[model samples]
Target: MANEIFICHNCPMTRTMATIGTKWKPIIIYTIGLKQQRFGLIHAKMGLISKKILTEQLKELEEDGIVKREAFREMPPRVEYTLTDKGLELLPILNLLTEWNSRHHQADFK
Candidate 1:
């Protein structure tokens, strides 16, 4: 378990947490999750994210091996981002986190 961290519990949940536990990572992971989407698509979907921050965060996720990047060689070129198999595994966890946030926080996006 690389980067495994356990806190306040008996099991090692921190490694899982490390993947999507941060402020923007989980949001990004959850956004381009099911389908491979372009940077503009993700940016449009995530209203609050700025271009600079989005670029930085995407690079970080790419470095962490949780996200995959695909680029095309054509006029005007296109690049898309998608979750790796490891990143896909976090969907259910993100769903649970969203649920908990809804119940406890009351319209987190609002």
Candidate 2:
């Protein structure tokens, strides 16, 4: 027991951050919203993010069970991304954070 690592394995915050703690993860989740969106649409919504980075983030979110990827065997190989139930649960929290920032970060707006 003495040599066991203290990595906050049981901490909810730590686990949450581990799942969606990157600059784009939360934004990506928010962007996906309640409907499915294609990779191009998500990329279009977030114009500043590189395609490579967006692909990587989406893959991570899918792996973490926060996002669902649906690939179709169609002519153009259509792929869409949608938020899973676990990801939907984070929307309200993200909204609260947005409100908090709006109220508290007025100076930053300028």
Best by TM-score: 2
Write one digit per residue (lDDT tens) for candidate 1, span 67-110.
Answer: 99999997789889999998899889889978988887866555
- Candidate maximizing lDDT: 2
Q: Which 10-residue window of candidate 1 scores lowest in summed lDDT?
A: 1-10
**Quality of model 1 by C-alpha lDDT:** 0.84
Per-residue C-alpha lDDT of model 2 across residues 1-110, encoded as one tens digit per residue: 53334556656778888889999999999899898999999999989999999999999999999999999999989999999999999999999988988887996777
- What C-alpha lDDT values do all the predictions have? 0.84, 0.91
lDDT of 2: 0.91
Q: What TM-score against the true fold does each predicted structure earn?
A: 0.77, 0.86
Instruction: Give the residue spans of candidate 2 off by over 4 A.
Output: 1-9, 107-110
